[model samples]
Target chain A: MKNVKKVLAIALASVMAFATVACGNEGTPAVGTESGKTAAAGTWRIGGIGPTTGGAAVYGQAVQNGAQIAVDEINAAGGINGVMIEYTFEDDENIAEKGVNAYNSLKDWGMQMLLGTVTTTPCIAVSAEAAADNMFLLTPSGSSTDILEGKTNAFQVCFTDPNQGQGSAQYIGENNMASKVAVIYDSSNAYSQGIYEKFAQEAKNYSFEIVSAEAFTADSNTDFSVQLQKAKDAGAELLFLPIYCEQSALILTQANAMGYKPTIFSCDGMDGILTLDNFDVALAEGVILLTPFVADATDDATVSFVTKYQAAYGEIPNQFAADAYDGVYIIKAAIEAANATPDMSVSDLCDALKEAMVNITVDGLTGTGMTWEATGEVSKDPKAMVIKDGVYVGY
Target chain B: MKLRNKFKFDKRARQSLITYAMVIIAFVVVQILLATGSMTSLMKGLLVPLCVYAILAVSLNLTVGILGELSLGHAGFMCIGAFTGAFFSKCVQDVITIGWLRISIAIILGSAMAGLFGFLIGMPVLRLKGDYLAIVTLGFGEIIKTVVNVVYIGRDENGFHFSIKSNMDLNMTENGKTIVKGAQGITGTPKDATFTIGIILLLVTLFIVLNLINSRDGRAIMAIRDNRIAAESVGINITKYKLMAFSISAALAGSAGVLYAHNLNTLTASTNNFGYNMSINILVFVVLGGIGNIRGSIIGAVILTLLPELLRSFNLDNLRMLIYAIILIVVMLFNSAPSFIQFREKVTAVVKSKLPKKGGVN
Candidate 1:
């Protein structure tokens, strides 16, 4: 009898607490804007979503910082079409449900457009909801095909995962970087698997043979001596790492220890390896990677963005930061091209932006005259850069 | 008929009714708030998931609290249920156009499949006791997640094809669709899960778990939990009772997974989805709610799940987790400290004496 009362007592108390929290807010309508032209805030609300704190925080934090820099510049230049652009970012923690919740939170804050969700899996989930709501979404660094597969309303600033994979294969084949290549990838991650699968398939078109394909799980990400040794034993001239730099750093150090110095090649995930804490820079001396942005590029646009980003964030911006910087400018172009107004409905603006995205090409930090396809893929050429004296340089 | 006639408004009956009424009243209040658009959007989005964690916590309690065994792999069972349930929904969604009917069938199938795995695993695993069982369950749990990542299935005009190698080996026709795409997971699963359905499932889980805990078998199970060898010496079938508790607990966890899968569009098998961390989280709910307390688990799951998301609203991204950690320690002290419980009991007793008695239901 005592136990029964205890159960009922706790249950009742908890329910009351929940009820109070649920009724804490008196919300307006859940949707962004009504069908008819509604009186709107003079500022364009652009909401960003990404993992601000987690294993993938590097990417999300870069995107957020980069977008903030661009937004500040745009608003300083008298905003987009003379209306100030209001920017807000929500942290998704790289979880799909949390990402959707962040999207809803942004909607509650009266977001007119979305600029992110830097990771892939969460982007896929959020993109689906954005597609249903007919919201205009432009992800900065979400490179998976699934994120934009059927969602025409969604666009990417970075090249798709397949583009990097196919481009790497073609680049290597064109320059004859290596005849025998050994690939190491993280199979647990969708982005790595997506790139690896395409690269392997595309490699058949080139003269190089993928000698050995080694895989690792998220749990087994650390300790790549076995993988490095296998690649060395295969007499591979080049080693392809379709993984993030966190693991790639350990792999390079281990390979250095074992005296197996093959030509190291990677995708964009290795762009900011030099900035990693406690990592020896000499290990990455001759590493080559296919990326859209090189922080040390002498080009005026790249140098300006890089300089401003470093002044603000106190670090060299990676490819993710560059993509997000390009994302904001591209949104500016889309709005100007469509002549979209703050008073227009969300669906109306989405339709206008969808058409404008493909027609208007914007030259920005990541690419020049970058145009988007109706398929939601960005058409951008990737530059092959090599690590020289600890800084990335043109190959 | 005689038993039905003999059913009276006893103390136990009244207690159970209070629990039911509490759930009902809360549901009604939320529905009103939702209709009026008064609930915060973050809370609104978290509605189904709150129910999911609550259900998962309660189900896990059946094993850790009632069965007196530590199972760190309960999330593995959840992963199995989620993937299978989502897969079934994707396969038959077109044929079974009705939402409620298909969801009903999916829940049953998902629960049954989880129970089947639990029973089969329990056969070999039940022989071991204590930490050995925990280690083995944890091992198998990871194995399940790892296996699902590699498994790929597709559907075409000809039929269904399965592959462990890769999605390419499925060799589906041009018109065929790849249902499972390795690590990318099943996309475009119909969003059939609703808050109403989640609440109904929670109620169903509470009924089964609470009634099971009160039955004759429940006594035997508890007796075994208290003194396994003594209960066995007194003619209790230890293996039978233990396996029964475990498999049923797993089935309920599976039902919770059904809700989890349908709630999200992209269903991928990540470590955070169903891994060591998730199992530890459910265990924390069971332990914090007070071992073997069903109502406490529900409340604990709700509060803990909402605490982090609620804190996010304040824009304290850096300090959000730090605050959550402090609150967790404080709650642990309140729930477990010997002096605190004594103080709380005295305070509650005084409060209870001043409350008026309600009319008994006849």
Candidate 2:
């Protein structure tokens, strides 16, 4: 008994020491936020919150790396409004409570401006907390209109849910993509559910007849055979998936095994499919999606941003990255318009940015001449991209 | 009996006091930290959740330890409480403008709703023992989460509208506002859960549970746990005691849920927060704290909840979860393994003998 006790104690002690040393091993961050010290003057402290550790990590990581690239470029170009930007992204683990904790921690570190919360639920949770403080927030990929409802302090870098749905239906209708459509979406996620509601409403005006609409929750995300087989049996020519890449990758594989193949259409949520670990890139072939950015675009801004991102992270950046990259520049433009300094209080800066956000137009890698309304929704035309040779090409 | 009367503490009363004092001291220390400006805002935010988890652990220990029944659906009771309470607050937030009064009624309503479900589920569930009971409770937890996910409730000037099909099915006037959006859940709940209130609730849980355990009903319940046949032979109402313990445990868990729903800025149904994952986490707290040991469960919950956050503050950002898993394994082994328990008992005996005895010692 004594021997067992000693052995367990020794093992736990060693493991604790190892955990301390392992913090700096990951290339993510050497240290986390300081508790008491606020951001110093002359540096605009911007904090981001997202799920860097959970099921939706792909979106969070893309946004984290993408926002970093933008900050680096702006600092190299002599800073935003003559002040350097300091960016810190906290992992929310894709849970609402943790997202609020992340927001409060960022506030503790004297964050002046916010750019985050990659997913919808956490974004909604954090936006409510941020609204209470009247902090200026620009979510890069949180496309739920609920995040902006009754709160003028928050804005979306990506199009709102209705916009994506309306845009996709219009594209499919004008191009005569398909006559019969089947939709499979995550009903629990605000991002997926919001888009699905609008898409179902908008599909009424299109040429397609809705054959099947199946819903899945996050807990039941693993098996898509049920949802897929139902859609296949409906004889739908096109499957519209308004969900994330994490589940879409599995859905495509499951559908493939069931010998079901149909034209696939998705929203910006399916942007990082090729980069998902252990996913066969070939399975995602011919999957067309409506998004604001395509990495392979020949535009000089897209090429430069894509090249820099690949050189830095050794992988092609996705639409989430593009949105985050544009988010920072949009923040810079709004800051320039307001002539706000880092020395200002968070509430003052938020108030100034709120007015300036409506008046600024940004030409970014995501979109050229992007503008936002006082409703906190961005106005930008989403482009259609098809996966060919495992890369997104203009449809 | 004369010595016990003179000392003003039997073993049971002393044990209960220790649990109360443990909570009180911790609350005082936290208050001091807050007043001193030493505590971080993140830690302050977690204080209410700590109370919630501690309450959950203590209540679950009652069903698992005292009743000797394995219940994996305690979180299901919690979810019922959370949604019911949240629904009431949403419907009447306008009518009941007073925060404390509204929240008090919400807690009572939430507790009653959860207790009703516990009684209903325990009727059939308590008939099964061991693994069968465990499986059914697990199913109950999943069923609650899934049911809440599909349920949509909205209210307008006309009345209340509810639908299981879709939110669109609830065709209300343009002025109508949704209280619960099917999967997304209720948001903007009044964040009224404070640390002081949490501590008070924890005390109430301890008071009720400790008192229940020392009562004649608790003795009957434990007898039923020890030997069901023997307990039945002694004329103890087996089903009555069993249902009593189970329902009370479920109701305490419901109070925790009431605190939880009000603590968050948004209330949503998800696996991580309200499903089997959370039920298992509470079970871990109970088991690691030595099952029936009420004080130990609270200590375990507080430590496990704060461990990751404390590690995060120490700059072990990503490694905290990994280290937390390892610590849980080690603690569970130390707690439950026979050899480790034997070793701990031996060491404590030696230490006790080394100390000088007081007059109360025979």
TM-score of every candidate: 0.93, 0.90
| Cα distance off (Å), candidate 2, residue A343 | 2.3
Query: How close is chain B to the truth by TM-score, in each candidate?
Result: 0.91, 0.93
Q: Which residue ranges in model 2 land beyond 4 Å of their true spot? A: A1-40, A254-261, A277-283, B1-9, B336-362
Query: DockQ, in order, for the candidates?
Result: 0.47, 0.32
User: Candidate 1, what DockQ?
Assistant: 0.47
| Top candidate (DockQ) | 1
Say which docking band candidate 2 falls in: acceptable
- Residue-wise lDDT of candidate 1 within A273-361, one digit each (tens)? 99999899999999999888888889998888889998998999998999998899999999999999888878999999999999999
| After superposition, candidate 1 runs with Cα above 4 Å error | A1-39, B1-9, B169-176, B345-362
| Clash pairs, model 2 backbone | none
Error of 2 at A8 (Å): 16
What is candidate 1's lDDT per residue for B112-142, written digit by digit as tens? 9988888988889988889999999998788
